[model samples]
Target: MVAVGEILLNALFQVLFDRLASPDLFSFVRQLGGGVDSELKKWEKKLRMIQAVLRDAEEKQLTDEAVKMWLDDL
Candidate 1:
């Protein structure tokens, strides 16, 4: 299945290309897509890190607030 963000980005690219004749617009879209993908990857990594930290904390009998604070520190 295609991701929603990818679909939206494709639509945006098509619209931009259709309305604008400048080659710079294509470059801008490519850069925007790269930045969006980069941020998504970072978020997924952070989420996994947080989940691992929470699991370790559960094993050690740490409180929920402590787990949250640890994630916040990250």
Candidate 2:
């Protein structure tokens, strides 16, 4: 009974997670070498935080205008 929007969001989340762990991305980041690794780590941390917030917002957006707006802004 999931809505299409929810399905698309889940798919997007999976794609993001996949890209984050991708070996090609890791190899390229390593090649970049001048603090790129650190930058990637920082982004990984931020993405995790965002993912958590996204899940919370997904559940809240149904009834909360502010949350819906926040999710939409994403």
Candidate 3:
């Protein structure tokens, strides 16, 4: 169950990053010209939040795996 949750979380993070990296979206945003618009600002906030969650998940995964391995070695 825990592993499945981790897999889903990783997949979600990948999809989010891929969407953020889309060239067409970046080009559209660039065309807007100077100063961040509300929509862009909202997206930036959401992206930051997603990034933070991903970072936390990664840290937790590493810690969990280390503990699991240590226990298995016991």
Name the top TM-score candidate. Answer: 2
For candidate 3, what is the total of clashing residue pairs? 0
lDDT for each residue of candidate 3 in 4-70, tens digit (9 for 90 to 100): 5556766776787677667887788778877544566687678778668655655665668764454
Ten-residue region with minimum lDDT total, candidate 3? 65-74
Greater lDDT among 2 and 3 belongs to 2
Candidate 3 TM-score to native? 0.47
- Every model: Cα RMSD to truth: 13.3, 2.8, 7.5
Q: Pick the candidate with the highest lDDT.
A: 2
Give Cα distance to truth, residue 62, candidate 1, Å.
7.9
Off by over 4 Å in 2: 61-74
lDDT of 1 by residue, 1-74 (tens): 33354446446545644544456654665678847545555655665565555446544434466654544443
Worst 10 residues of 2 by lDDT: 1-10
State TM-scores per candidate. Answer: 0.40, 0.65, 0.47
TM-score, prediction 2: 0.65
Instruction: List the global CA lDDT of all models.
Output: 0.52, 0.80, 0.64
Task: Estimate the lDDT of model 1.
Answer: 0.52
Per-candidate clash tally? 0, 0, 0
